[model samples]
Target: MTDRFSQASGTSAVGGVERRSTRSWSGVAWPTLGVGAILALVPLWLGDSRVMMGIAVLGLAFAAYTIAFNLIFGSTGQLFLCVGALAGIGGYGGAILADVVGLPIVVSIALSTSAAALAGGLLSWVAVRRSLGVIFTGIVTLIFALTFENLLLGLGELTGGESGFLMEAGRGTFLRSQIPPYYLMLGMVLLTLFVYGSLRRSRFGWAFRALRDDEVAAELAGIDVARYRIFAATIGAAILGLAGALLAFTEGRVSPTTFGFAEVDVVVLVMLAFGGIGSFLGPILGALTFTVIDELLVEVGQLRVFIYGALVIALFLWLPRGVVPALDDLLRRRRAGS
Candidate 1:
């Protein structure tokens, strides 16, 4: 892990001073663009099938969520389990603002995203201030997730409760279209990748790697652990919120199931685990792989969650750090042998 971080961070000692290598940044940028370009070609093949295209858009949204979650859990050691809840805030908040309050869609999305970000930041602050461990942090966040769901149900008049809330803001726009929304979601995924890659090559990434490796050591080395964790959570939550809001507008509805904990959080966690935590392409790969798997598992009906649980157990037992990091290690070893 230490060696991997050192290499990815591109640090070199010269005359007792640490310098970053531009090679790493270039390496990251090209691959990111290549991946984006490849994904951009999906619509060419699937354009005719409305159902498939819709599913693809949803897959892209999950990819976006994985990226945001990767930034929070993969970057820092923060074990936040409220991924769905935070996104629910964005989706529901945007729906209420745009449909009920008569606010513009853009304004509603912005405000909702901001609210999610603030909520995430506050959650992180509480965790840090209380010196919560990973398990305790997860527990707290899980509780918050449940609470958010109950809150939505309790305020049925506003949120539309179990029946869900129908949104009319982007009804007549391109958001309701199959192709355009797919591209919009794809663009969001690409933009998130760019931002994530940029961060990985910056000082922030260095700090994140440091803290993740060892919080006490990172603090001793002069990194502000609390501030950086909060920043990551806030930024990730903002992305989650924005994605959720856009999805709500695109679907023209907001429902508890859309951002339910079991629906979003569990899936995202599995995706991140499969992708390799903290690896640049991990989230995208995981989301793509699992999206296909999930689609196939639709036939199983109630057994899907059971399969997911089994997969999680299997992954943690055999490939705990995920596919990308394991493959990276294998390649490095093979090169050394050569």
Candidate 2:
């Protein structure tokens, strides 16, 4: 009877923690959701389809991707450098399934996402399961990224290779414009945020936090470091892959240039560095800020790259952990002073 009672109490305590987490997330979510709603309406005021589609919609997609990256590197403390490549795998896989194999869009996306998840799990097993150090693990993933790029290029007939290929736009349209995809991307961003918050509150999250802080201690605590590392990697990759499938549908094309290592991998890392990793607002803020900056600098052509590089350096110098954490610290200080 005592053992049973103890188990019941433990379960209830876990339940209470979950409830508190939900409440905490709800407190933070309201402001973020309100801001997002306002941004969603901005497209109507601006009345520019290019701006709406290019910056707003694509930024939403990239935010999802960035969140995925942050989870693996920031939360789990495992640096898997194949973010865009997994996304591309999902993109190309779904495109082929939907466009070529005549599968339904839903089925195509599901299958592709599953494929990405499997790949992520396999990557974790191959790279980190043997207890490889962090730097070597990154190198292995980077090699996978390079290999994936080559595979896509080599499979010209399927993935359009260097020349690129257009997707059949038979579905995913709304009101004869890009609005539907925009909303779709927005929905995805919200979903990713929701999952991120839930994870942040769960025992899984605590495990990640512990693992990130000290693997040996986490293992001693019975956290199963290898299992959770794979969990984080697989979950993040699945989110990224799903975003890629959505992007393939949105952009209506698959190409090598779209998923280049330097093009996406570096850009995402820089965005995370700018946004503050391991925080909920970091990925969204970073992706949106960079996308807008990119749009503004569009007319400047080559100068934009130089400016971006300079800005990143400056941002690091000014706010080492990115904007959100710095802002959070400022708010805390102000409150304490008051």
Candidate 3:
């Protein structure tokens, strides 16, 4: 009777936590969708300027990247430093499959996405097997990123070297059009948000939080830490792959610069940091804010990277928890006072 009662109580407690998580996510879901709706209307103002529209598309891409990073790092504590490399794998892989192999773009995207997921899963498996902590995982992934960049530079004949590979695959299609590409990327952003939110409301979210809060405790509580972390990494990597593949198609080229670590990974980390690491709307907010900042600093030229480096240090030092969570705390304080 005692064992049965204890088991029943534990089940109820777990159920209560899930219910609370669902409610918490539900409160934020509509606002997230509203933000997406607002972004969808951006073509209304910038439709005439191709340059602005291009910047907007790039912003959405970065937003998607941050979201993927958030899922891997924030949810499960896997610090993957090769965000750009995994993305480059998809971008370069898709372009090669379409242009060189003469496969349909859709087929190429699927294959490249699958390849990225497998690669991500393998990386996660290796990390788990080695019992690597966050810093070690980042170090290993950073090495992978460096190797990928060198590979692009070395394989001049195949990858077009630093000149970039012109994607004849998406040429003359709607992807080349100015407006359609914006909506296409917007769709991806919204889809990614939905997926993230859904995971946060499901059993996966519970497991993620458990492991994130304390891996040893989670393990004691019967949570499979390795499996959940790898699953999160795989899912996040698939999103990154899909986003990268689409970016290649829309941009009509793939270059080392396009998916370089300094370009994609650093910028994404800054965005994720500024917006809030674990907050639902944090990545979008950070991406949007930094995208505009980046465009504004375009005239500064070479100095822009220096400025970003400074911002990364400052933001991490002062706003470690990020703007979204900070603001959320302030709001709660005000409500309590009222």
Q: Top lDDT: which candidate number?
A: 3
Poorest 10 consecutive residues of model 1 by lDDT?
Answer: 9-18
Query: Model 3, residue 211: displacement in angstroms?
Result: 0.9
In order, candidate lDDTs are 0.83, 0.75, 0.84
Off by over 4 Å in 3: 1-29, 335-338
Candidate 3 matches the true fold with a TM-score of 0.91
Q: Report the backbone clash tally of model 2.
A: 0
Q: Over all chains combined, what TM-score does candidate 1 have?
A: 0.91
Q: Per-residue lDDT tens digits of candidate 3, residues 235-294?
A: 989998989999999999999998999999999999988877766677888999999999
Model 1, stretches more than 4 Å misplaced? Answer: 1-25, 328-338
Question: How many Å off is the CA of 101 in candidate 1?
Answer: 1.1
Instruction: Tell me how far the alpha carbon of residue 186 in candidate 1 is from the true structure, in angstroms, after superposition.
Output: 1.1
Candidate 2 has an lDDT of 0.75
TM-score of each: 0.91, 0.88, 0.91
